[model samples]
Structures are given as C-alpha cells and as structure tokens.
Target: MNWDSDELRAAALKLLLLATLRETKVAAPLLAELEELGMVAPGTRKGEFRLLAQQEDKFRRYLSVRWPEFAETEQAFSARPTLISAIALRALRRAPLKLPAGITQLNRKTWSAWAGAHSKSGCATPPPGILLTSDENLRLRPNAGLQIIGEQGGTLDADVCRALFGELIVPERGFSRNWHVTGVLPWLVLTVENIGAYIDITIPPWLLLVHAPGRNTLLATRFIDRLPATVPWVHFGDLDPAGLDIALSMRGPQTGRTPVPWIPHIAFELLETHSLPLSSPWPTQHLPQKLLEHPVLAWLIAHQRWLEHESIVVLSGLVEDVTKLAEMLRER
Candidate 1:
C-alpha cells in the first residue's frame, strides 16, 4: 500500500498503543489517559499483550529519540510516532502486534482503519454555517427562473451564480430580484441556530439566512463585507469549544463588529443540566492566530468549556430565544 504521511502516522499510533499493552508494568496514569482520549476499543483491552516478548533495539532507539519521556517511563512501550518516523515505525511495530492463527494481515488492516478514524488529534474542520452569519436572502421567486442581476447592473441567471459567482451568491436559494453591488443591509444578520432549521427563514423578517453547510464563513464574510459596519452579525450554536471557535472564525477581522451571542443564557442552562465535560485530552487548537488572541476565545480555551446550539433546539426555545435576540439587537 502507498501510505501517505498521515496514514503512516495513524498506523504508528496504533503500534504505540499495542506495544504499551505489552509492558509488564502498565502504568495506571497512562491507562487513564488512554481512556480519556477514547482510544481503547471495547473487548480489545481485555486481551493479553502477546505480540513481541523481546523489544527490538532499533525500535527502542526510535522511541528514545522520539518520545524520551514516554521511553523513560520504565515500561517497554513503543514511542509516540513523530511526523517523519511514522512509516518506519509502523513497519517495525506491526510485527509485534500480530494476532495468532496467522491473521496478522487482516488484523493490521482492521486496526489501521479503526485507529485512523479515531486517532486524528487535531482541531476538527469546522462545519459549514455553524458559526457564520450573512445578510443573504433565502426567499426564492419561483417565477424568477434563472435571471439574477449582476454588479454591472446586468442580469446573470442560474448558470452564472452556480458557475462563476461561486461563494458570492447564496447556495440553494435563487435570486428573487436582480443582484446589485450596492444595497442597504438589514441591521441584523442572524445565522440559524441549526443549519437545517427551515422554519427560521421569515419569522423575524430581518433575520438573514446564512447557509454555511453548503458554503462556509469565509465565503459568507465576503458577502457580509458589503453591509454597513453598524450591522451586528449574530450567531447561535452549541456552547462547546467547537461552537465558540466557529463563531470566532466567522467574526474574522471585523474587530469592531463582534457577532452577538443569541440567548447564551439558554446554552449555559443546558450545560448546567447535561453537565458535559468541557475539554478532552485532545482539545482543539485550531483557532486562527487572530481569533486565538480574542479575550472571549482565550478565556474559553483557558477554562475548557463550551455550549452547543443543539441544546436549545431540544428545549424548544429556538423561536423564543431568537425573538429575544432580534429585540435585543434592536435595542443595541
């Protein structure tokens, strides 16, 4: 198999975990860490470590240089895979994890896929529309067919919006009227608490639909730039780290116009009820450098807490909270 760097690294982690299982004096802390990371699969933790009785000198050398701390733990576990040594480590570590009955190849394939899915420890790719808001209209003129007005005061239809306009045009929603370069933006741009909430479209009238799953915040930002700076972009999402990070990403460099949190009290309430763990052993470090500097984001990261927008949907407070948000923004 032509393993890429990412695949090789994934394979190496599996080897490291399996090798650690072989140690006679398995440390309690290490096991706890593994559990916290959700790395151990059910039924697999019960098996005895029968892979390799004797540690290879080359493997030991690799471990010493790669993860010296883990190597010094007095346990015979394999080293954590570095970005470069993953390929070699996988080759060396696999032999020791072979199952009996000569099913090593089958076991290796299964373990590799499972580990690759679960072992990705970086910040997740933020989902579309999760935290961005724009003043894009979702109202469609079914009779309007494809003709959309262009910036040059000419009309371009569905073909142009779909092909050339790209992120400049709203997804799924067609132009009800001709598009123009200059127009007055509404005072509030509201991103739906749930991207799939079709019921949210015209409730408040001023709430603009931001269909981010079909696109993303970066694209939405392009459209939002045309709006007046006084317009406050509001976001409602889960109260988790990812949700806050999404909001941070959507806000971008418009430091003056922070996206208003819609009914954050509801998220906090749900968080209190669920009592969910705020951070993980592998917390996301994916916020952009600019966003990382924001005080709110910095505090969230420091405290390791977030609230999800989904919690509001479950409590049936979406409409009421959104109504409150519109009223609040008007007051601001």
Candidate 2:
C-alpha cells in the first residue's frame, strides 16, 4: 500500500496532530513506519507521480494553524516530535471498529479533521497504557534498559544468538576446566521489522550454554557498548528497498563493517524464483544510485522483486537457512 498517497498522508498528519492535542503517551514511530506513510514506493520511475509533497505542505499549514506550538517546520516529515505525536494519537484511537457479538460501531466521518474528537462530548475515557500497540506505544525505550523477556538469563544459548545475531559473539568471561563461565555472549545487534515479532516470538534456548540470556530479551541501544568491537551489528528485516534502506540508516557512516543481511541468500533466491502478486502494474525504474552497488539490492531492483520479512519467516527452509547462515557468520 503506497500510504504516501495524498489522502493517506493528510489523514496520517491530521491523525498525528489530533493525538498531540489529546496527549497520547507513546514512543515515537520508527523511520521505516514514517517512510511507509510518506515516501514514494520503491522502483518507482522518475516523475512517476508528482508526489503528495503539495498535500504534505497543505497539511503542515493546517497543523501549524491548528496547533502552531507543535507543528513541524522541517524537511524531515518524520521528525521526532511529529512521529511522537502520531504515536500518541494512534494509542487513543485503537478501539475496535465494532463491539464483540455483532454490535455495530459506525464511523460516519471516515476522513475526519481529527481523531478522538467530538464537538458535543469530546473523547470517551482513555484506555490503559498497557493496552496500546507498538504503533501507538513502542517498547524500544532504551532508557528502560535491556532485560531478558523469554527464558531466564543464566547463559546465552547458541540458537538465541543465531536468531537475534548472525551468530556474532565472543565469550564475555573465559572458560574454565571445571566449568565454563557465562557461556557465549551475543556480539551482534538485531533490529526487527515489526515490534510484534520482536515481542511475541519465543526464541527457544539450547541448554548447552552455561549461562544463557533469555530467548526473548528486550534489546535496547544502551546495551550496544557492551558488545565486542569485532561483532558487527546487523539488521533483520524485509528484503525490500525500504528495509535495506532502514538497515543502512541504522548502521550510519561510522561502522567499519557492513551490517550483513540476516537472509540475503533467501531474498536473492526469492527474487530469482517467485513473482509478487500485485493488483496493478508497479512503475518501472532504475535502482537508486546508492543501492546499485549492492549485489542483493541490485538484483531486487533489477527484477523489481520485493519480499516482506513475514513472508520469509513462513518459508519452508527459513529455520534451516537461518541456522546455516548463523554458523557461517560465526566461523567468519
């Protein structure tokens, strides 16, 4: 869904502004989410669509008029403040469209000026914060620090590292003849495509480790410094242009080593073998200059084939491939 369509962008922006007015509490939206809602689709030919840049401008003006104090005046539409506002607004509007047991809830105004606003009565009671979704309230608050979410922290399991890291690790404490201490520690960083996957999936731990960090640990930025210098931080995400771009952005310009793809081989194979089911023709365009040099990205662009992380997860050979890749990286 090219959410950056004029209607969607304007609706998103208005929704964002409405969230701020109501003071929705949540972590800001991630850049990928913002891009999904704003940027042109990948492989789009030059001058395909003029873009909703004009609509965005109008929305910004409306925001400035409606809430000048919180309006964004910047080139990056997904500025922190704007995203945070959007998160808050989404948190407030999460009520299901209809009640359970065949009750109907009508939204007469589909494209309303605001969310959770009523001229006559205002919003109903706000729901508890715990019920908010990641789009509304993400759990990636680094300040909260890192803690194991699944299993218990004693030793780090090899499978856990394989799943979370590309099997990047070095022992934090040296081994002993009588007993190895702390087992193997994770050296790589993982950035999941969806927060739900990050939270819901239970990474079963192999009992071989002397001390395994729980399978479901909430990874945070504050823990990066603890990793070994040799361990390259990698991102696991969709095999699409946007996902690749997100990984590059996370690595920034400073990392000495490229963040290896968690499943580039699979992605390459998918591109070579499968066809995307789209309702309409996608615009044909040359790959972006920055991405052209990358072999995996180049292939995807050349074929105009894109794969979502969810799809990859369900592939028959995913687990085996993931484990094999982990071993390969570990040896490297």
Candidate 3:
C-alpha cells in the first residue's frame, strides 16, 4: 500500500525507538536524531518530511491505521532477552485493558517494552528467571541470584512479593505426578516430599501446558534440578483422564512421578459414558505409559478423549490431601 511520506517517516521512527530505545518520544526532534544517524534516506520527499514536522496527535492516527500491517513489537521481543522494571511488566501483563487506543495497544506495547528492555542480540540466549512464588517472605531478583524457597535465603520486598505472585498462592502448576507408597491404599491421598518440603504434592506443569520442563529425574519437570526427589506426595487432582495423564507423566523411568488415582475411574467412566474421546482427538503420543500401565489409568485413556484435575469437585480436597501427603513425608 502507498503510505504518505510522513507515514513512512513515522513508521521508521517507531522501528528505531522500539529497536534501539525502550520508550517513546515526541516526533520532530526524534526525527532529527534519525536524520543524523542516516536512517532517513536522502531521496525521500519533502512531503514525507512533513512527518518530522507534524505533531503526534495529528500523525498518530495515520500510524494507528497501519497498526496491523506494520507493528513488529511482539516479533521483536521473541528475538531477545530483556530486563524491565519489575513493576512495569507486571502491570502490563495483568492489566484488564491494554493501552494507547490504537497503533501499539497495551499488549503490543507491553511486549515491545519487554523487547526493548531485553534488547539482546540473536546469538545470546536468555534464560527464564523465576517470576513469583508463594510464601510472601520470598523474593528473587535477577542480579541478586537464586533463592531456594525452603533453604536459607535473603529477604524480598513484601510489596513486590504480593504484587508479582498472588496474595493467595496456589502451587504454581496444573500438571504433576502422584505417587503411592507400598502400604498406601488406592482411594487414599498419597504424598511425595523432598527433605523439608519443596513442592509437597502439586501437579506438574506439562499435564496442563505444552512443553513444560520436568525436573531432570524419574519424575517429570516437577522434580527437575531439585535436591530432594524423595518427597512423600499426595494425589488430589481431578477424577479424570487428564489428571491420570498428569500423574502418569510425573512417574516412569527417569521422571519417577507416580499416578495415585484419587477418585479412580469415576471420571473415566463418566467421560466414556458421555463419549468424550469419540468427540475429540485422543492423546496417543507422550501419554504416560507407566501411569497408563496402572490398571485404572490405562482403561480411561483408551475410552475417553480428555479429563482434568480441575474437574474435581472440591477445592478444599487438595488441602486435605496435601496435609495427608505431608504427614506421610514426616513418616519418612
């Protein structure tokens, strides 16, 4: 599409601001800065030069009209590792509404801010830092280094703590492995534990989100990089195929998470009766064979399309199960 010279100039300025700098600036002077840098090619028309001469409120609409076709902020952020004032990123990600009315809306703006804040070159890969955790007392800063939650660590700003992680903390995962000790019965909640109580008995990430990093153990990412693999665990997820999948993922060879079915086969039967899997695609690949090998899980996977722990009836159920799981840990 043919863009007026001012529009092109405005577009160029945006690229420069997002690519090189983290914030926005008024036009005219910013354009002068661009001209000095040779970003403005010599042949562009004087009418295009009007971009440098125009006020933001006037030219802003022109840019807004071209937003979908031109904005590359999200793409830009995906290309790098960035640092941002902790507060800003949080505000943008959770804000009920994004900003700017058009052009770079809140989502794009936030993502762009992240890109600029991160602004790393392609060759250098950035690692995901811990975002937030339960336990209001806990805090982790990029430069301050890692804080093993249960281990002796430094203090965090209380305000930042509640803001980042929610005030009421749910264990930060939806997928997890459930296990049973020799004496533990099927219907009862089983528990897993690390030395003290790292992640008592929570769902692993993979069961819910795709491509979660299971801990580097027999269990899934749930146990990755942790010092204690022997935590007593409890089974408190839903009574369905998906929960079983989560339990199964946690168990088996390296990531030894076990499947301890709480309301075993109840959801599986309900799902099959409702003809679930027949309605949707079944997960054939990466379906935890070990957890499936458990008589109950196998039957459900074969009959149903999907089931999740969330389908479980009670929220308090997890708390009760966790306590039981922890009690079992104290026994060990």
Candidate 4:
C-alpha cells in the first residue's frame, strides 16, 4: 500500500495517540513500515504489532522529521487537514458571507487559494461541519438556488420577489441565507430531477415545481423547509437507483416530511412500451433499504431495463394531463 496514503497516516497517528498511554497493538500489515523502522515490535498475539510507550516519542520525532503532515497534535486529529482548518477558521470569522449574486460568480480557484488546498475539488466540496452561518451550517455557499416554476403571490420576501423575472426563476442568492417564503403557499410541491424534464413539464396552478438536481438537493431541501410542514411534496425523476436515492434525500428534515416518490402512471406505461436496456449494471448496494425492496426497482432489475423521465414527458404526452396528474397526487 502507499505509505503516504491518508489511511496509512491515520493508522500511524492512532498508534502515536495511544502509545503514550500504553502498549498499542495494530494489525501487523498496517505498520510494516513502522516495524521496518524499529518503532514497533511483534505483539504477543499473531498478526499484530505492539507500539511500546518508550518508542512513542521516537516515533513522533521520526514522523516530524520525515512526514510532518502525519505529526499532527491530538486536537488537530479530530479536525480537518491543516489547510482546510485554516480556511474554515477564516470563513467562520466572516460568517454570513455577502455574495449578493450568489456563490456561482465566485471563482473556484480563488476559493482554493483562500483555503490553501488543491485547486480542483476543494471549492466544490468543503468540509460539511466547518463553515457555519448565523442560522445554518453549510459546506459551500449554494452556487445555484432552486429553479422554480410557480407564483409566490406575495408569499416570498420582497427582496426575493424582486429577483423573479419570468415563469422560471433561479434565485441569485443562497437559500440558507435570508431567503424565505411566507403568507399563501402552494397546495403541493413537485420536485423534478432533470433540467430538461423540469422545463418541459407543464405545472398546474396548485403545484409548485422545483428542480432537484441529482445528489444536489441542498437548495431544494432548504426551499421546502421554509414552507409549512403540512405542504405536501412529491418527486419525479428517472426510473433508476440513483434517481430513487435523490428522491429519498429530498425529504425535508425541518418540515418532518418525506416527499412521496411521484412515479407517474405513464412512467410504467413507457417502461413497458419504450424502456431501454441498462447500459451499465445498476449498483444496487448504493440504494437504501427502502429502494432495495421497492417493487418498481425489483421489476427493473429483473428486466434489466430503465426509463428516463424525459421519455415519460415526451412519449406519454404528460404536459396536457399534468393538471390531472396533480389532482391524482393531491388525492393520494
């Protein structure tokens, strides 16, 4: 295994953390390099290595000399990497960051530079518990707000309402900030997954349509949380494992409401008439237990077939019957 890997380093750090208190035993294979360095001796039992208390200081010194990153203090052990910690500390000092135009306009590389981390994925996925706002803890300031197709009718805050220009509005601000909706509310909220299907579907007057992009349900969840707990929500997405998980993740914790999976009646019809062969094996292990036992998923797995939401929108001519579909969901 790579000696400098996080897993190896974390194992080494654990040994250092505990060796001072008593003889610490770890799997023999995990510390082969430490054994080679004469820092760990074979334990009393088979397939284990013992780090003696006397060797703890020598081990820490060796790591500090060779790999300083692994020589972290006890407090820093539970914390993020040094670079990430520094960035989070700075961000906490300037909590509730002002981004009038939202995080999308902020440069990724600039964010990385601020974090002192590798410039690729650092900005995209920050440590989840770090950057805390006055009201909520956020990983990254939302780069995009939930795209919506419906009228707020003075329900939305004045500042947010001013940002609306047309039938579809993607707010330029983060949802975790001051954005909120009050007063009158939609009878039902339908979260659509794909952008193509999101734009294509005709929304009924009583229904509020919000785009729930795959795995990025942050904004959508925040928007739903602002609504009353009784406001019913449903989800429509591709008939697949990932889509089902996305729908599951859309459950609003604040409202204590789990959105009903809106597998339109036409979806099953299209699955039978125009279903496509699975291009790749469905990673069912990634699915939650609820989805694993789902009848539709079981049928899809048995048939090795999957259907896209766009197909249901196109082949089923759902745009015309969307109002009736809304009524069906409300009736349920």
lDDT of 3 by residue, 1-332 (tens): 33333334343434433333222343444456555744443224442332233333333444456544224333333343243223333333445553334332222233445433332311222124322122111111111111223223433332243346522122333212132112111222232222112222232211111122222223223433132344333343443545444555465444554544344333343454443344655565765454556554566556655444433322334445444544555576
lDDT of 4 at 121: 36
| TM-score for each predicted model, relative to the true structure | 0.38, 0.35, 0.31, 0.51
Q: In order, what lDDT does every prediction score?
A: 0.44, 0.39, 0.36, 0.59
Give the per-residue Cα lDDT of candidate 3 at 326: 48
Runs in model 3 deviating more than 4 A are 1-7, 10-111, 114-227, 233-275, 314-332
- The TM-score, computed over Cα atoms with residue i paired to residue i, of candidate 4 is 0.51
- Alpha-carbon shift of residue 220 in model 3 (angstroms): 12
Instruction: Give one digit per residue, the lDDT tens place, for model 2 in 5-36.
Output: 33233344544433222112221232234346
- Encode model 1's per-residue lDDT on 1-332: one tens digit a residue: 22233343333344454553422233333334444544432234554222232433444454455453334332432344333243344444444553345331222234444333333322233223222222344422111123445655775454334344321245422222335323334446655445544233333334454543322554455445545666667765655555555665565434434565444444444544653456463155664565456554444456665544544555555556666766776787
lDDT per residue (tens digit) for residues 1-332 in model 4 = 45444434555566666442122243345476677878887666665566876778788777676555543333465453333333443444345554344333334455555443345536554344334222222221111232223343323332243245324444424553454554446667778888788767755445667777776676677777877766677788988766777776666656656787766655556657777788777777766666556666667787888878877776445644555655665676
| Strongest candidate by TM-score | 4
User: TM-score: which is higher, 1 or 4?
Assistant: 4
What would the TM-score be for candidate 3 when compared with the true structure?
0.31
Output the lDDT of residue 86, model 3: 32
